[model samples]
Target: MERKNHIILSILAILLAFSFQESRAESRDSLFFEWYTTTNMEPWKSTMEQMAAERTPDNYNQLFEVVLAWYGYIGYCLGNDKEEEAEQYLETGWKFLDELIEMNPTNAAPHALKSGFYGFEMALARYKALILGPRSVSTLKTAASIDSTNIHYLVEKGNQMYYMPSMLGGDKEIALHHYKHAVELMISDSRYHQRHWFYLNTLVTLGYSYQSTEHIKEARKTYQKIQRIAPNFKWFNEEVWPKFVEKYGTF
Candidate 1:
């Protein structure tokens, strides 16, 4: 009878542990989506810091989450014209990312992320572009060579092409092609389309590119697709859509 009771107690303990793990996973997912849709950085940043502090050797994904959250926070600061804050976050983010890269040099994602960070830094100081530009291009090329289909690498390449001056080989047509290829890659992976914030942002970039090129119909269709997928995206619903309507007369 004592042995039977012990076995039952062990089962209950196991069940409780499983339940706790499941709850934590759900909470993390919810927090990620909330941050993605609303750009509300504080809550997500707190959660990521907590997760990172608790990370074990087996918790690689948690570490990646922390890095990705930092990336998002940097973007948020830059978008709001907080250049100093953005640079601060960028430095901290690079500290973590550089460690990860050293640990796993062949992983393409970190390389892609580092490449993007260099580009962001260049944007903040165009004078530094002469030095940082080659670094950005080289890192991205390394990432692409390692994993040609990596969505992040593709997006960075597209962004470079989109923003570079025509004199420096920036072609809107080629940029569109890269963006389209990235979208197609994401579409083929349901997990990316459903949950990845970067995938959605890539779509937004593609839409704006279309608008810039005076492809109104395509731009409106892209925006409409974003609305259908994530109506809570404030930038699209509040800013882009209104400006688009004002300029192109409501699609």
Candidate 2:
């Protein structure tokens, strides 16, 4: 009787672990969609740690998404002053990214993602910027050179260009060129259908790039385009655009 009870308890624990993993797997696609669409972290609040803890090098692209998702979530945490949480995500994200690049040494996308992660590290520890800043730029440029036409690479490069200060080599004009080329690539390519997360994400950044450069008219037009395509994008619709309207008044 005692032996049977012990076996039963062990089996139950194993089953519970498997169930948790399966649940995370089932929710991956939906949570990803919501992350970029709703831009709300509510669904992801409890999953970041689980996702990172389970990170494996088996599927290169799968691990890539985990790290990228971490990057996104970490950004939100940093912006909201959740320093401790952001640091945890940042450490795990960088570790996974390193593992990814080790396995896929020449992969451009991972390198691009690495560059972005470096930015997050710099944000959390400004003292590290001196070393990480140039590394960030070079890693991204290497990614772009490896695959100039990749929309993801272009968008990330543009992000670096658009957000970094001019003193640090960020130029809004150059960023615009990268963004316009990305938009053109996305439009002409059939792989990214309308409302695809990357598709919409590219446009969102392009809109912000326009705003940063004081091209209000172009920004408004971009906003209208997003409204037409992804009217329910809660991040832009509920938060970003409304704030823009409050400051600039709607077009």
Candidate 3:
């Protein structure tokens, strides 16, 4: 009786361990799915780490495309200082985007991603915009048309609207409306990080818009709120405000 009882306890312990491991694995997978959908690449770095561990030839090409896209985006966010890395990933991302577009010309995702890549390149190298603005604008329009149901595509369009001229139908009011719509649609997603990022970006955009229209007090409040929320935020402190100061020279 004593020996049988001991054996049962040992089996229970083993089962518990297996269950815990499986639960952790599922949690990780869920996290990655959220990141991939929301375009949040920071914490999703672990997914790339896992891909590196299982670098099979059959999966390598797809993995490379994703990695390039993520890195390209990350470097883009890092601002003008990382120009070299940004350019490298921009090139890599375009190649992959082109391949994906060729494979499925009507697929909305590739066009959306391509539009973003071009926009990032324009931010990093202003001259690129002079050359590629028309192409990027066309691609973004196609992306929105192709994926009328995806809020992400709409949000991408909203972002493009901010930079485009009035002749191109880029209206700040329309952009704000769409940004609010995106936040409403995606806020309840289990992806907290992605939601958080969207919130932050929206805040920044709103703040800048207020500043642009001479709402100095409102912009100052927004900037102060950003500092309070993310005191060490990379772009907010370093790149964004400096550019603002340079442009208005007293704001």
- Could you say which candidate leads in lDDT? 1
Q: Number of backbone collisions per candidate, in order?
A: 0, 0, 0
Residue-level lDDT tens digits of model 1 in 1-251? 99999999999999998788767765666667767789787887677677667876645555666787788778878888889988887888888888777767787888988988997798689899999988988998999889977787788888888888899888887888788898988898744654567678788889998888888899999988888878898777789889998988865
Task: Check candidate 1 and list the clashing pairs.
Answer: none
Q: Could you give the candidate ranking by lDDT, starting with the highest?
A: 1, 2, 3
Candidate 2, residues 125-204: lDDT per residue as tens digits?
A: 99999899899888988887788777767877888888888887789989988887889888878545555556777788
Considering TM-score, where higher is better, how would the candidates rank from best to worst? Answer: 1, 2, 3
TM-score of each: 0.85, 0.77, 0.58
Q: What lDDT does model 3 reach?
A: 0.63
Q: Give model 1's TM-score versus the native structure.
A: 0.85
* Worst lDDT 10-window in candidate 1: 190-199
Best by TM-score: 1
Alpha-carbon runs more than 4 Å astray in model 1: 1-27
